[model samples]
Target chain A: MTLKAQHVSWRRGGTLVVDGVTLQPAPGSTVGLLGPNGSGKSSLLRLLQGIAKPDSGTITLDDTDLALLRRREVAQTVASVTQHADTDVDIVVRDVVRLGRTPHRSPFGGELARDERIISEALEHVGLTAKADRLWHTLSGGERQRAHIARALAQEPRELLLDEPTNHLDIRHQLELLELVAALPVTAIVALHDLNLAAMFCDTVVVLQHGRVITAGPPAEVLTPELIADVYGVRAHVTRDDYTGRPTVTFQPGPPKGEVLRPLQASTSVRSA
Target chain B: MVVGEQGRALNALTLPVAADSPSRRERQWSRYGAASVLTLGGLIVLAVSVGVAVTLGPADVSLVNVRDILLNHLGLAEIPVRVSEDAIVWQERLPRALVAAACGAGLGLCGAILQSLLRNPLADPFVLGVSSGASTGAVAVGMLGLGGSSLGLSGGAFLGALVAFGLVLLLARFASSGTSGVILAGVASTQLFSALTSLIMFAFADSDEARGVMFWLLGSLEGMRWNDVGLSTAVVGVGAIVCIASARSLDAFAFGEDVAASLGIPVARTRVLLLILTALLTATLVSIAGAVGFVGLVLPHAARLLFGQRHARVIPATIVLGAVFMVWVDAASRVAFAPTPLPVGVGTALVGVPVFVLLLLRRKGRA
Candidate 1:
């Protein structure tokens, strides 16, 4: 149930995409990864999922070294919904979900009765059951993203990983999907660009800057005007909302030159909204 | 306490899902059933075509005589026929027709495998230069007196085909664009091999030798014997079984490497195995039939359109459809031109291009 990485580093070409980062998500906890573009969120997720090996470090799922396990073994325990999962050929949504049964399937067996149920349940969870028969190419961008999520959910894995799963979603769908992810009874690590959604959904938040972990804690503790001003360099109004008591980050409607970086990490004044 | 309601709601919501599933499964199974029926129907057409194709030729053999000859050979029934007519039907025509069918089936399977493995709809064995390379080898041996017998020509062609396959792999490895790079490399190798073939034909061979080489290049089953039939049957039969076993691997490849790897398929190993197997299949067919064009490329698409994108259905359908298409094409070549033997390859492309274009147009129209 515990998924962790220790001092992981990965280099692509001449640049260090993920540099000396360690992550450990608590069992059954949803961890939100907050990072600017090129800050290594996707790279870190790839390394954690055992799709790409880190140059110098170790990854373990449930205390077992991930590199030691076969791809099938890793896939059986860990499922991921990446941002860029598209096929050139024509396939239906249900068939795409059925692919999640790969690790559980026998070498020569047909799609089993159990596999079909899981696939259907995943479709139902994503509210894509009605669109199951539609060709993949005919799906809208947000629907495609949801279909990928359904495919990942069909795996019924102990750990679920997603990278920017809400990229193409409309506002309503974005909220619904985050709600669904938070409600799922499995460990999750989601890379998110939205601080408010992360604050509202994730139990723990980790922020990355320039391929390094800058800060990590519970969302209420970690999110601050100082962190937002420092990491994102945008003037953001930080406050505790009356109902949820979660720290909400709203960018102030002003020019970038209107704000200055604060000196101390814990020194930002917060106003209740 | 709040989470408990949604959990209960999710479970309750999925119960009606149970009500919806049986009919869906039935629909899916029936679609698959229809695919199987289509394949069975194709097999029947192939059987009938083979029987009819054996009767079609310059030889004036009656349909009843053709039937009696076939039945007598099978030991199902006995009827007397002239030895000459029996020889024409049994020794000459039957083996040729069967060889056409086997070559067709093998090439179609290779085409489908190549397309899936490469994740490119337009990809086929010929796109990898296997056919061109085989022609170079066969021409070098058969026309230039390098290898005296047809057997030597076949061996030379196979070796050349392997060379082309290796060259394409090496070039594609160095190239950055991966699949597209492989295709570019194949085009380069095909041009190189085809030039070599042309050079030998013009500079080395006399008129009669050149004509014989031309016949082989353009694909004629004129002198196909029982041995060719037996050899092709063994190769295509074994190849079809291998393809069927590998169907799941092919299915995983439709989405590309990362997704396929996540699906527990060994992407690199499977790609290598599929490419090599398909190359071997194409090479075998090329040696026997001299690179019969279009069947390998078009029939797979036709099969997929008919049977759906699943390789499980497409593979069987392709085999049957390819066999039947080639049988009719060969028969049309034999009878339409009379004493002037039409190259089956030319005839295949002549019919294939229009039909393939219509299929493409129809697919777009459907979309």
Candidate 2:
């Protein structure tokens, strides 16, 4: 049940995108991979999902190298929901979820009773049972994200990887989606953009900068204002949410020092006037 | 074991009672029932279409006479029939109609597979330049006498189609290796081959050779025989089996390649195998029936509109619909113009453009 990446590094077109990173997510925990743009969060998720191979290091599941296992064997245990999973095919929600059963079924076999039960349960788990037959094109962004999660769930995977699953979602939906992911029984490694959301939902958070891990620990310790400013180059105030007892990040409206523009200054002056 | 875990998690929250709900189960049944009924209906329509179309030529062969010829030929019944009517039904029309049906099914299946594999709705054999390459190959053999001694026109066309497909794949790989890249490369190949074909015809072919090549290029089923029928059916049959076997792989590809890889598909291997299969299917059909347009481009969308987007259902539906559609189109083209038969490609375009425009307009408002 162990999924570990030891000293993993990957490059794209001669540029290093994920550098010398090690991640070993504990079973049944929600771990957040947080970083700014081009910080290698998505690339790390890709490596963990076995969609991309690390150039220099190894990713192993249950002490065996992922490169040595067959793709179907890996997929039966790990399901992934990509950040921008959209399709133009005139497919329904249930049909989208049916794709999760691909690794489990043979090439020509029909859907078995067990498959149907699992698919139904997955949809139900995501609170999408009523909208199972709705057309995918008609779904809202939040609903589409939920449908993707349900599709991942339908794989009956022990480990789930999600890449920015809350992007384009409204605040409430973002909270609800994270809550759902956090409560899931499987170990989940999520790449997220929202620091507060990551802090609220993730048991532990790992921050990356320039494709290298800058900090990794419980969100309360890792998501400090100094760390946020150093990694993201933005000033932010961090506080603990009284209700949830989690770190909350509030960003400063103005730009950082030595980068203040005329338009921003004028806007501030206008607000004062 | 995991079900109990999921159950416990849901029990901790406000759980819905829809897990294994009877209503959802009934809906699933109805969906499958509808698909089964449609498939059965399509098969019946295709069979009837071939039979009725065989009776539509200038030979005055009746439906009963055509059926009797088929039955007699199959050794099912021994009904005495006129020699001319028997010849018309068995020797000529049946083979032509069957070949037309096979071409339609094969082309449509290729289109369906490409649309999914490439993640683009406009993907088809013609769009990928396989038909155009086949045309060029056929013309090169027929006009310039290149490879005529060793590879016949069909063989030359098959080679040319594979070459064009390879060129498109290489160009797409060098440029972007995305869906748009493949389609753009296909466009470039199509234009390049079409120009080459024209150059060959203009420079080398005599008027008689030019006229014959022109008719074939526009897709004619004028003199098809039983051998043609057998070749087309066997090719399409094998291709269909292979495609159906990989239906889950195609389903996984509904999203982009990255998502498909996550689903445990050997993305590169599956894509290359299917792409080559489509190329072979297109080349064989093009060599048999010439470049019949629009069936490949139009039938898959029609099938998706009728049935849902599951490749398991969509592929079979497209095959059936395309076969039925081509049989009628060929029959109409044959009988409508009397002595000077209209090209089957032109007939398809005439029908296909309106349907294509309708589908476009319908999707204009959707996301």
Candidate 3:
């Protein structure tokens, strides 16, 4: 139940998109990966999910190198929900969730009673039980994201990786989705842009700048005004909430004064959003 | 913990459980039962269609006679019959109809697999340029006499198809990657091979030779013997098994390659194997039947409309629908022109396009 990335560096085309990054989240904890665009959050998630190997360094699950394991073996331990996961195929909500059982099912074997119960539970967890028979194309964007989460949950993986699962969600769904992920009894590494949401939900927060780890610690410790200003090139007011005792970040109205922080530059970085 | 409690409260309010509904296992079993019934029924219909179609044509053979001949050939009975009737029933029509069924089934399966693999609704067997390559090969042998009589027309066509598929693979590799690149490469190869076919026909072929090639290109089931039936049936049978076994892999491809990889499918290996399988299947069928057109393009969609989109069900359903549709289309084409015969490809398009348009409209309304 351990997933660790050691000195990982990944290059896309010619640019080092994920450079010398290391992440080791405690088991059964939710870790938030926060960075501006092209800061390697998604690329790191890809590496963590075993979709792509880091150019240098190693990714391991319980001391086993990801490359050494078969794809099925990796999938049984790790499940990922990609950003903009979509399809034009005429599949229903339940069918999408049923796909999560792929690594477990024999090719010729039908769904067993156990698989069915797990699928139902996953749908229930995502609050999609009522729309279980709805066609994928007809779902709203937020519902689609929930369906994807449900699909990942159906995999019953020990580790779950999600890239911006709340992008299409409204404010309420954003809170609810994060809450759901946090409550799940599995290790979760979420790459997100919403700083406050990450602060409220994540047990630990890791910040990336130029594909390098800037800092990693408890969100209250890591999410400082200076860190937010340095990483995102903006003035952000950080305050501890009286109720939850977590950090809250509020961006200033205008751009920063002088060259105190440089806005993210357009680069030849080939990290797909 | 308050946030978590709020989330739980929201879930309780919004996500009601359909507690009394049938479990997914029960639903899947029912679907399987339905598919089994459909397969059994399709098999029955296919056997009946072949039997009834064999009795048709200029010969006045009866359904009873066709059955008796079939049973007698299999050593179940020894009913006395006239030699000409036996030749017409056993030797001529039976093989042609059976071959048509096989071609239909194979092409439909190929279409279903390609559409899934490419994640495009428009993909089909001919999209890989195999049919055009086969055409060029047949023309080169028939018109230019390249093989002189050793490498027959079918063999030449098969070789040509493989060459075209190879060029497509090479072009897709160099030009770009992914399914779109392969499709574009296929288009380029199809145009190139089609030009070559036309050049050979116009430059070297005599008028009669040109007409003969034209008929074959339009797809004819004429003069089909038992050997064609055996070859098509064996190839298609094996291909169907391979496709059905890859059903889960195909299902994983609905969200493109990256997601499929995340789902634990070895996307590269599975894609390559399925693509090569499709190319070989398409090439073999075209070489035998000269690129019978619309069945490959239209039948899979029809199957999806009837049986939903899962490949495990879609692949088998497409095979059955394609076989039955071709049997009837070939029979109609044979009888519609009296002494002269209509090309089977043209007949399929004439029937298929309208049905395809109807399917498109129906699908659009649902969406």
Maximum-DockQ candidate: 3
Lowest summed lDDT over 10 consecutive residues: which window, candidate 1 chain B?
B12-21
Number of the top-ranking candidate, with lDDT as the measure: 3
The per-model DockQ list reads 0.34, 0.40, 0.41
- Relative to the unseen true structure, what is the C-alpha lDDT of residue A246 in candidate 2, on a scale of 0 to 100? 88
Write model 2 residue lDDT over B248-329, tens digit each, in one string: 8999998889888888898888987888899889999998888998898789998877666888898999899889989999
Candidate ranking (lDDT, best to worst): 3, 2, 1
Better of 1 and 3 by lDDT: 3
RMSD of each: 4.6, 5.5, 4.1
Task: Give the TM-score of each candidate.
Answer: 0.89, 0.90, 0.94
**Runs in model 2 lying further than 4 Å from the true structure:** A241-243, A253-273, B1-37, B354-367
Can you write out model 2's per-residue Cα lDDT over A136-159, one digit (the tens) per residue?
A: 989998889889988898887888
Give me the iRMSD of candidate 2, please. Answer: 5.2
Global fold similarity of model 1 (TM-score)? 0.89
As a whole number from 0 to 100, the lDDT of residue A208 in candidate 2 is 84
Docking class of 2: acceptable
- Candidate 3's TM-score on the B chain: 0.92
Q: Candidate 1 lDDT, tens digit per residue, B1-367? A: 2687468434632343343456666766776678678877888889888988888888878888999998999999888889999999999988999999998898899999889887788887798889899989988888776766745777878877888888888887788454678789889989999999999988988999888778887788888999999989898998888888878778877777777777667667777777778888888878888888889889999988866887888899899988988988998998888988899999889888898889889889988
Select the stronger candidate by lDDT from 1 and 2: 2
Say which docking band candidate 1 falls in.
acceptable
